[model samples]
Target: MWSMLMRKFRRFPVFSLDKRQWMKNVIHQEVGKGKRVIMFYVDIVKLTEVENRYGDVIAKRVLHIFERILPHVSRQVFEIRGNILAIQKLWGDDFAIYVSFGGDVNEEDCRMLSIHFQEQAEKQLNRQVSFVNREELRVHIGYAAISGQDIVKEMYTSVKRAAHMAKYGITSETYTHVTQFHQVLAEENVTMNFMPIVHLPDGETLGWEALARGPEGSPFATPSMLFRYAEETDTVFRLEHICRKRALEQLRYVKPQQKLFINLDPRAIDDPFLLRGEVFARFEQYGLNPYNIVFEITERHAISNYAVFRKIIEEYRKKGYLIAVDDAGAGYSSLESITEIYPDFIKLDMSLIRNVDVDPIKQALLETIVQFAEKVGCKIIAEGIETGRELETLIEVGVTYGQGYFLGKPDKGMGHASGQAMNFLRTMQEKKASVREEPFLFTPAMSEILAKTITVEKHVKVRRVHEIFEQNQRIESVVVLEEGRPVGLVMRFALYQVLGGQYGIALYYERPVSQIMNANPLIVTKDDKLDEVARRAMTRDAYHLYDVVIITGVEGEYIGIVTVQSLLDKMASIKLEMASSANPLTGLPGNVQIERELNKRIKQQVSQMVIYCDLDRFKWFNDRYGFETGDQIIVRTANLLKEAVMRCGSGDDFIGHIGGDDFILITKAAGADELISFLLEAFPLFFADIYEKRGLGEGAILSMSMAGVCMIPGLYENVEAIAERAAYVKKRAKELPGTVFLDERDCAADETHQTQV
Candidate 1:
């Protein structure tokens, strides 16, 4: 009789009606006052279908179970009704709860609460509703934290969007994709790999591009698959957020002054976390400055509104973050984006860079883009360079930077170009230097020649100085200093001579050495050239010629002492190396020397002009004339070129005989044009004399064609690319009649010049 009475009263209301209106008003008021609110949107998976299949009794029982358990999840829980317009459109079949927090709230607490409520609801619903071959009822929970004032609509939309994404796993056919995405989120499985963007000319790394990767062997293992699935499921914002966080975390190991490139999807820009200071804060946590970060705005998807996008990019720029327009030339929209935004870096699409070495059309297109970038004052980074030829071609075409398998593959750590990439760079650099004929000049400074020596104060006891000479048999001299300035020199033989005499120790052993010190010694600054110092040492009196040379700084502070033997040794070594590297016929520096000079200039960050000079019709002249006569002509031309350089260029300017009719000259950029013009005028006069002496016809006279390339050291990676460009300009010069000078300083300049032979 009790069981029958309870069944009759089972239909009575067990919970209060949904108070969505009251909850909405409360959320609005709290949000308006800048209080933090968290909204948990909970949806019963296929609830309507479950109700139809299992009857009203079971559906009502499932709702009653959620109402009883939600109070345990949070003290500020409120039931959401369908009356609120924003919540109604987004909530759909999902039941919503508003949880407000005062002061502070832990994100982990909210996550645990959502999980507990979902599990409890599922357990109760599964027990009450069952059928043949029926799927178990489950709950999908989505939550978002909202702060600041008057964003109730945005708050609801964000939570509702998250819920819809959470529910997609149950309703969509690709359940595995959804499940894997959630697992990644829970486990934080997203990670980043870095690929180096190297300066192609020198193989120096400019920066690394951070590439995102998901868990291995999963459907979302690759960035393309992962982002595509996220976009389809409306979880792109969350995925991008996780990716950015991981990228920033991995940047801790990056070297100082090296840039870090991080990709950002335009659609994810609206995320509150991204818009607020969260991303900047994360960077700060990793000790990364905003100036070192470059936000690569990827163009994989269309940007719906460029105005809004530009505004966001401008905001980031104002905070010292750089912007790069990625995948340029991939589509018209990317071009439009770059034009509208004027990014700091424009990355060329790999499609255009592929096989560029063999395809003239691709080269032309790349050349055009490089010109455009130069005009806009943006650097061009060629992407996907996979071969040596492609890298060489890019460098030849004046691309400032590049990244691809040819340089380095993406790895889990900061890596540099290796294997084939390093070998290719070295090989090209060597090839560029193969034409030089003179040994490179290496002048050792006083610092390198100085020998570490013992010094004594001017007032030291004579007995102690005598003991020092006796302790070290090889000691020739000791420096006496007043403070840090060298004032006197004490010779070991002189001290020994005075101290070895009878009664010498008793007479003067305890006195200060200032009485016996020479008070005059050879002193040279550290900046003094080795050769000059050696000459000064040789000019000393025969007895004192072997005395140590005291070295000092600019302020006259004693540094160390140098022996005559070390100076002679260094000078000998330099002479031997120079002799071995000089060209036999021209007696000038060769390839090895030229490369060393170029590297030194680059290291010193000097601005210089490199000129490639070739004699037109040299091969014909050599073939027609005897070998000896041809050699004579080559020698004569070298002499005239050297004369012109010495007359018009600085003493530090370099001249090299690159074998045969080719020569190289490195000089200051300001005087390079004048030097070339002088050579153009001087060479003909010498040729005229040779022609008159040999009784040769006008056909026998060959004119000189010079290609001059002006460069600043940091602007290029290596000398090979500069050499290649000079060769190209030389080829263009050969096309014109008579001796012509071609200027390829502006890479985009048209090929036309008016110069006489």
Candidate 2:
């Protein structure tokens, strides 16, 4: 039947192999006759939906409806090639028809023909498929006149450009054209750009997020425009599938072990082809592993059926593919989806991460999310980190991973982190380690307290060393170094004693310093803690206790020297400062001291408890009673906490006061409950005497309300967040008329009333 139709329209042939040659010959013949050919590129827009809903059989029938209607418009037909034909079938629901006319052919005639063909095709297809809606069968037609010198080239370019424009609702008499989503997909004109996701603290590349861009200078060039058009036309699945394949094909540009995060619309989760291991096979074909691929589900729409969606995710997980909830906090349904799916990673929406360093509210929200992630065993990745301050803030809040322009922008290669970011990470890490190791002690290393000492090579003459000591009267010791590393120390008195002997000068003069110098001098690294170095110095032999401690770098390179007296002075000063920072009445640490302790614990990433204790109605007691009695009560309460910590807390436990009736207790998570219980049971006994003396009943006396917040370090930004949350929980405890309350939500506990004791 198709062959007979071709014979009737014998001027043009319809065959897969010769379609291009047929178009070329027809355009040449018409132009050779001095004729103007108007080419119409007709594409069926709803064929994809038809294919998806009814099967290829019904979809082919619909395509034939276009084929039949096109002959009525013009006898010359040409089929477009590539993906437009390969996947769509036959003409792929897209074809071009040319009509040769004289120069007198007008625009009005072309318009009328276009309108008639569209209306007639719709009516005929609808009549044939009575069960389908007429609106479901639609076509887009674009036409351009060809009269240029190179008719084949001009006609092909003009008609293809017009078809692209018409598909996206653009039209013009001029040859200017706009590219659309369908044309882009049909031509496979999209490319993938990758942005690195890095570990914030060290700037190590963890993975890359694949981003898609349409052809350059096209209307759908940008990712936003391309994706919007795809969604509008219901071609998102096809477009995304192609993009994922392209991204995987370029996996050779990335490290094999690094993760590849591909953005996928939630609808893809329901796609049968995608779920049947097609994508898995593609990954394997490209030498990639499913375990390293993270399908970042872009939650632009809510999951209508969570059970089915979860089942699909479970299937992916079983194949070793990880799931990430993208753009978290951008919409209301994101958190709900996260709760339902429990994704392995949650990407914080840029809105929350932008300028977070300057915004306390954002920081608080991030802290809450970090705490939540810890409880759910999920990692939090902060996206759109555009500045160093933002990255620093993310690190401070313990964001597990980060991706932004500041770290590295999206490009087409396996890229490393920015040099600036890596250096900053190293500095921050070193500073953090220093802070954690030192805590309240300022043990100046040998590098910091190095006393000026003359250094000589082991080969230096004894006469020269003696003259050096004689010239510098204050020089108590001389260091002997070979190549930058200290090998021996020579004391001034011992050197003078040796030289004072009758034959000592004759024996040692012009000899190497190694013979006269103490070969095994005390040594310490530049990073050695001052307290530790001091302990080593004191344990040495009494004669060598005052000798200098040699400082060396990591490679055993000589740096400087420190005396025992300097180390003793620094330790005494640090102890004095700590003592002065403690609360005078209770002898417990104050706010400044508490913060230092908290910072140490947080840097170590240890699980600890922050208990905020407030004496309920203590202000009333202070008002009714004298200041002396109030002081006595405060002292007694502090003593009770100290005693309980001694009994139930580890030696590392810390007690502090925020001043007045508020106190803080820092202990291990294991010991926190025990400590809180002890305080609750013991506080009433200590308060009973005060109530009796005031002639007040037990109910009227001020009770202690303790709100405990237990968390691992790095889950919070700073000690302030810990204090603020504990205070909030303390307020909730007071509201509930309970003496003990625990914020057991493991985050910023909101359901405090239910967990009261």
Candidate 3:
């Protein structure tokens, strides 16, 4: 497919020195054929700095990843409008694509296409590659539509001019942040935070890792955002120097015998202060012991040459400092670094530690790493142990040390782990613990918990609503509908408060319900995720703070309502389920967050896919087989979906449970068929064992159903549209027998082991 697409348009595998001439030739040819030409200028923002700092190898690798994903993303984005005539590198880290549109294509069309393509391409770059650092691989795309009057020589120049305007334009976010970045550096506004690293076996504070922050409320306040700007602006070393200096200044709070773990990026390993012995000079002034300092080497910046890195590390070792690899399992080169550096400690990445208690694979991996650490004469420290189960699991796995928000959050002052968590672990070590439930790990949709509240049409008199409220004192709210669609809401408390006032009822008794009803009541469709719904519900002003949320169907028809009480109850259940799940490393986003993200992408008008999933005959299966067996199937379904996504989707793709027997997946439309093919192939096959376990034939087992909504440019404005279509398709999929998928666009059902795509 890629080859075919490349063939359709002239393209080079790499940036060529003669790219300008190549692009000009393509532009001239396309224009000669009566085609209106457009130019796309692509850049890996500040990639030259990356080349200078990390060397050409890393920079070239970044380019290679960028080059690989561009064609695929561009083809998906540009497929709707025009043909990509040619794609070639015109200069260092800057590439151009010549697109041929019809004579009727206007500049506005080109502008929108460029903006959408840029947003998507940038998002793809960050997800497609195992990026070098937390700094995302982002691109700045600028484009120009060639006018018939323009010379071919000016085509490339136009795109470059657009690129310049976009990058340095007064409204550019980078420009604003860069200005803020200068002020931050000039003011020396960095703050240091230290989070406790506990000895897991005893839950004792073993050390504190120093974390840096910019000024509060500034764009660079968050460490990730701060350092990302630093990398882009070529002030990484300068920023690190300042952070290290600030970190050292906090040594006054360091307890004797407790190590102070300082983060040291590989790019900043050779900082001028470090080479000049200035950092060493500050240790004595801070009354620090050399052995009490541990340099936590981040894996974000890959070590290009280990031999040189080993020599550098040895120099630090000679100064009586210890070395530890940070985020050992997350980065591309962490494991290799472990064997090469033989550091004093390895901080297992959160990806490995999240939900480690429940995952046998993670436990096995952790146990293996623990054994290896012992052989290497180093300790294994688990990071991001957010729950007691995780902490206890680390202990059982023989991981001697740990760090995370659960252990202790980074703070201005060094703090200790919660006494309750520590005590719980101690007791569990001596005896078997009871299975206790945490809050629910998954958010429910309104369908799972919507209250059957009374709804009235907008024409109903306010007096009638008041009488209804008075007769049924328990009804806290009423949804006002017009033409069967919800138009407003009336809260009982607010209504009564007004009516209880002198002559309040006589003044407006016969008025339409809309007069007093909250026209802007917090409303969500029944399919919306509850967590996001609750957030929106809570954001209401104090007057309507506890007002019930009006729930509606896709067409705005009033369905029911979820009062504050019901939302809180579901939330409490979620909390309990979370505690009960024995796993705190959650991977799903809340519904609102999911919608927010999907809608943002949808507004870009790029093609994408949203798959709504359901388990066929789930209710019947759960009733006959009981909750335990039903849960096992749910787990299997989740695992299968995850496998499909991991195999066919990019890093940014999403799979989330939308309550009982329902799930949602969002991915690039280009990969939708592949992902669907994978799930169609895997789901029923993986669940065959459950049938055998229940003494039933494979043909009689509970199966899977997926309703896919393929969103095309301008076809679906938001995730809500996708959901609305998916909801319809889901019913169709469920109506059919066995594991099957129904795409709203295709209007065809894919049965078990038979992928339509």
Supply candidate 1's per-residue lDDT for 753.
37
Per-residue lDDT for 132-222 in model 2, tens only? 5436576677666666567557655665555655575323332222333545776688898889999776677888999999888877778
Instruction: Give the per-residue lDDT of model 3 (tens digit) for 345-366.
Output: 8999999999988999999998
- Candidate with maximal lDDT: 3
Give each model's clash number. Answer: 12, 0, 16
Residue pairs with colliding backbones in model 2 are: none
* 1 or 3, greater by TM-score: 1
Model 1 over residues 533-609: C-alpha lDDT tens digits?
A: 88767644333467788999989999999988888888898778778987888887888877776776666566788
Cα shift from native, residue 463, model 1 (Å): 60
Q: Of 1 and 3, which scores higher on lDDT?
A: 3
- Cα lDDT computed for each candidate against the true fold: 0.72, 0.72, 0.73
User: Against the correct fold, how does model 3 do in TM-score?
Assistant: 0.37
Q: RMSD of candidate 3 to the true fold?
A: 31.8
